[model samples]
Target: MSLSAATLRSLKHHNYRLWAGADLVSVTGTWMQVLGVNWLILSKTGSAASVGLSLVLQALPTLLLGLWGGALADRLPSRPVVLATQVAHAVLAAVLASVAMSDPASMTPVYGLVLASGVVSAIGGPALGRFGAEVVPREDLPNALALGSVINSGGRILGMSLAGMLLPFTGAGGLFLLNAVSFFAVIASILAMRASEMHRLVHAGENSGSVRAGLAYVLRTPRLLVLLALALVLGSLGRNYQVTMAAMSAGPLDAGAGGYGLLSTVFAIGTVAGGVIAAGRPRLTIGLLLGAALLTSVAQSVSGLMPGMAAFAALILPIAAGAVIIDTTVGTRVQLDSPGDMRGRVIAVQGVVSAAAGAVGGPLLGWLCDELGPRLTLEAAGAATVAATLVAAAALARLSNVRLDRAVLLPVRGILRRAPAEQAAALP
Candidate 1:
């Protein structure tokens, strides 16, 4: 397929197009709010620690209650669940805007609103995840997911750029108000979608133990276990780029804030490129995910040894690209492998693991940076990531009859075509 054709394939679906448009708006607004919040906290407290604490407050609820939310998603109608959450988000954004306008110096209400928004996100995430699949045909599901990532990366770049321009006049209050309006765009688009056209999956039946069922399912599935293990390690050790990059820019590179900003811009660009590349693929597989993870870790390790800022910056593009490929591939695999009824629960489980890794890894990596120096910290993290990938690959090879050699050599589509019926099913 031509590049445009490949990238635009998912947009052929009407529902997906609507969802994509709305999501782009929503994600852009979200990034603006993120930047506004960081700026506000820094200005008010003049403490980096305070800014970090605000982020932790936002992520904590998602880490703790995500699974229960997923279970709820499985039991309820996805549309209603999503609508409710979007409304909740809008209300919170409006409240935050009011507080910012009325009492800009008060940190307590701002923190409370951020925490509330996080709670709504934790509950809505799984439903929104499953809803995306419902909007597109099965063959287009991967493309839709890839496109979603593209929207996220593109929006972050756009929103951050716009925030820089808008913040001087509007203040954080204006940005919050803009985000509040963005939520309505999504709500309107969703309302416009044809319910009958959606490829609705069968809902998981109501059960008191539904959340536990998701946990049990993961424990029983070897492929899922391996996938999660790799995710845990990569997320915890390899993916704490904020900490590593900040330390590297300030300490070893002596590049300061400008260098950090440049690095972030480059990484975001690379991520957008990766998402477009992933959208072109016809299928995703375990081999692709593992290969991407291994490549990313290796590249990060090598980049840490670069002698100058320019050389390190050059290497960061591939590192960022590889990370995005790994994330998209793993997410696609999880959605594909899961049964319709259990998809929400499975996604929630993945979210929980990722959140937990971030919660733990951020502090650990920061400590490592202080103790071992930034360059050594990156090298150590890369080594840990490589070790985790190897262990996961070994277990997969033994449990699922996956040949590492073949997995490494074959294109995902070719590998699927060549495998025996039962072996293909068994191959992770």
Candidate 2:
């Protein structure tokens, strides 16, 4: 297939097209809110630690209930679950907008609203993943996932730029309201999709045991374990870009808000490029995932050492691209590898682990920024990610050796089948 055709294959499906459009809008709004909230906190408290606290509040729910949410997705129709979550998110956004308008001097209300939204996200995240899987044929899942990453990256670019432009006129309250409206776009699209056209899986029954089953499966699967391990390390140490980038721009670079926004835009451009490249790939593999993680970590480290804003901006391109490649490849692998009935649960497990990492890492990184400085913070995170990736590679190498031995034994077993049974046994 041509590059465009390969990258756009998932969009050929009517349902997937509708879903992608809705996702683009919703994700854009979400990114806007993220920037708005973080900026609002920084402006108020003038501390990266306060910004980190907000992120912790947003992620704590996922760490606590993400697995249960996944189990719920397995037991329920993804459409209704996703719809309910979207509605909840809209409501939360509206509440946040109202709070922002009220001009509370304290961070208490903002933290509470963020915590509530995080609760909804924890529950809806896995169901949303399953819903996306339903929209396209199995063969096109990787493409769909890559396209989803593209939307996420593109939305960040648009949202961050818009937030910067709008911050002066509308302030954070207006941005929150915009996000509230954006949720409806997704709700409408979900309503538009015909259930019959979706590649639905039967509900796995409403059993509490299902949650444990998902956890057990991940523990037992060597590849899944390795992937999750990599995610935990990278997510905790390196993925808190909102915190790191903000501090870097405002602190070390002395660039202020506009500069920070521009950096986000530059990074997002790289992510869009990475997503497009990932979409063109025919398949994903463990080796590819690990390699991407290593490259991303190395790039991040290099980005920290850049002497000027222009050079740092240039390095961020590869850093963001590498990160996107890792995310898309690992996400596609999770979807393709899991059993249909258990896919939601497996995804939830991943969400929980990642969220936990973020919760812990965000605060720690923020503190590091305060104590050591943004430059050292980025370098430390990159080093940690590199260490984690190497460990995962070593583990994967062991698994690869076992698989290779099995492959070699398979041909020997085949030769034995061609020989007389007694003679084959004697030769062995």
Candidate number with greatest lDDT? 1
TM-score of each: 0.95, 0.85
Model 2 lDDT-worst window of ten: 419-428
List residue ranges in candidate 2 displaced over 4 A: 39-49, 105-107, 206-209, 242-261, 367-380, 402-428
TM-score of 1: 0.95
1-428 per-residue lDDT for model 1 (tens digits): 78689778999888888999999899999989999899888988999999988889999988889998989888888999999999999999999888888856669888999999989999999999989889998878888888888999999899988989999999998999999999998899999998888999888876633999988988999888889888989989887787888898998999999999888888898899888877876665677676677778888888789877898888888788777877888889889988988898899998988898899999999999999999998898998898887787778777767676545434333423644212322244
Could you tell me which 10 consecutive residues in candidate 1 have the lowest summed lDDT? 418-427
Q: Tens digits of per-residue lDDT for model 2 on 315-419?
A: 888778777877877788787888888888888988887777777787788899999999988988898898887777767667666343222333234222533
Residue 3 displacement in candidate 2 (angstroms): 0.5
Off by over 4 Å in 1: 409-428
Candidate 2 lDDT at 70 equals 88
Best candidate, TM-score-wise?
1
